[model samples]
Target: MAGRKRNSAEDIVRKLRRADELTAAGKTQEEIAGELEVSAATLYNWRRQYDGMDTDAAKELKELREQNGKLKRLLADAELEKDALREGSEGKILSPADKRRAVDMLVTTMRVSKRLACRAVGLARSTYARTPIAQTPADPDAALRTILRDYARTHPLHGFRRAWAHLRHDQAIAVNKKKVHRLWKEEGLQVRIYHPRKRGGVSSCPQTEADAPNVVWAMDFQFDSTVDGKAVKIASMIDEHTRLSLMNIVERSIPAQRLVEEIGKTFALWGGPPLVLRMDNGPEFISSALQQFCANRVGISYIAPGTPWNNGHIESFNNRLRKECLNRNHWTSLLEARVVIEDFKDDHNHRHRHSSLGYLTPAEYAAPCTHTHQPVDGREID
Candidate 1:
């Protein structure tokens, strides 16, 4: 047989707390009884017993109830703060309309956050009800087709946003970033993968120059053979700023004596020596005699090893000389190579249209000084 139920002080306290929650929710006695797993009679009896009791007289018990209330409020406030912080981080703010749209999207997608869904629809929680929600894309296919057709030709590697930017800036096509992103996804256009560049060894002498011609010079050697099968070295000095061949000498070997003699000849012809002469780390360049000549005789500074990109002007000119002239023909003798190199040099400095000199020939680009033997600024041809 079941024992008769008795309401204890603990039971009274638990019922009182449940009653407060139920009352706040506007639930009646029947609803409270159902929620608390108690019979309607039990709920009514408990309410009658405790509802009129002096809660203050049980001060110690009341303190526990008040503490529970404070804890619940604190938890609720923390959750709100957390939600607000998340929205702020994502550049989203909630208004009345945002709340409704978020609720709707959550019902539909069941994946995205409520704040994010609201942001996607451009709704604010505070003013969502007042403002109409922005419409989603009407014709997604048309948008994708247009984006691909316009961008796929010139910028076949463009991603959605880049394609979108190009369209807006270059083609005068106007669209939102989100819409462009969607179209990009649908079209499957993306940037090509590329390997990262690795750092490499440096060249000995650095190529340095000023704004004008005759300021910086670059010297390099070309190996040639004599009729008797002996090797000869052709030392050429090129003006970095002007793209002019200041000195072109075909010698048996680049001895210190021969090199100094050639330098004096070049100085006499070209007027004055350059501020700097960029050269390689070969024996001809780094020899004690050459080093002494550069430091003491010429009073020029030398750059350290293995960096060549600094001498871009000379490098580009060398490439042109090789591709157009040297590579096109073979030399049977050193004299033949010297003759060809000299003829090519004259043509390059006098007749050839230089793109860097604004399409002007070297002679046309080089400014003629009215005074005797003065160096002139060379202009780039467009």
Candidate 2:
């Protein structure tokens, strides 16, 4: 015998309505059941359950029940995923090895299927299924790591670019800078950076852009103290385009006349005066002595008061000088400070690899420009 078939809620409701109509017409229960193609007990049960329900209400009820079941399934899946992630690890999973470990945890502890575990951990099923190859016993970067460690020890202030330059040029190692940077990171070698509180303001003066080597020169002052707490003021001048430290004078104090004398010496050394001399509105820079000195020879471009960013080239040079020299040394006397600062200035011009100049020293970058200019007399002042 064939099995009994099930009726939908709408169909059952419709059949119950038909049964009521048949009863009103004086048909017996058995006759109504026969007309509905169901047993008498089944017809009674349908009439009791869906007696007052219309077809639309029955259809809506069925839909609501299906939606509820779907929601229950979704909630269960979410809970499972949450438990799986908790069993894995904290924070981001970066490496493939980390991802593999997460997938294994999900499979073993969470009792999740391999496909579901891989999906939850964001790993490819094929990658998770494949067995990992054994690593080679010989270390390829052993020699490079030793070299980098020694370099880092000697030059703590230098970063990976200087290390890479040392390896390529000094040690004659033909290695890519990117690879050096990778090893530098893996070895935990990095310059400790100091972040200062940011100041908010825009420059009131228009910034002068230097296009060529001798187009513009930037000058600034930096101060330090000796062991006796006596003031050691530093005056620095650099070509804005080439980043060459033209002059770095360490003195007890720099009056306007002395500053003008130093400027004359720098001009004589560099061949001629720059098109513009960029400086802040300090008293020395604005004094009649320095003003009379640059009145007819070189143009003066003073940054707005209290705006150091307008004179950015000299500010950047001062920052480097502080980091690489002043902060690293202890001076006992005036002569010692001058000698040490002068040596650092020479090193900065000849040895420091400037990133803006494609890893060339300031002297190397300014070499071709130096050859193009004719020498000027140091005594030609108005």
Q: Pick the candidate with the highest TM-score.
A: 2
lDDT of 1 by residue, 1-382 (tens): 9876665556666777877888898998778878877798877766665665654544555567679999998786556545544543444534444356455644365454555445544556455434332334555457556657676654453356556555555457776768777556545565564544544666443333345666667787777566577776767778765678788887667787678778878977888776666765667677777666666335343445555545556666776676566656667777887898899889778765555666455666677523222333533111
Candidate 1 error regions (>4 Å)? 1-207, 224-230, 296-303, 368-382
Which candidate leads the pack in lDDT? 2
Residue lDDT tens for model 2, 1-382: 9887878988999889888899999999999999999999998777766789999888887789889999998898888877787777589987666788888878887798887788788999999876654223366888898899998997788899999988876688999999999889767798788867667767765555676778789999999999999999999999988988898788999999999999999999999998789998889999999989988789888887887867777898899889888998889999999999999889888888888887778888887764333224422112
Per-model TM values vs. the true structure: 0.42, 0.62
Which residue pairs show backbone clashes in model 2? none
Global Cα lDDT for candidate 2: 0.84
Worst 10 residues of 2 by lDDT: 373-382
Question: Which sections of candidate 2 miss by over 4 Å?
Answer: 1-137, 197-202, 369-382
Q: How close is candidate 2 to the true structure, as a TM-score?
A: 0.62
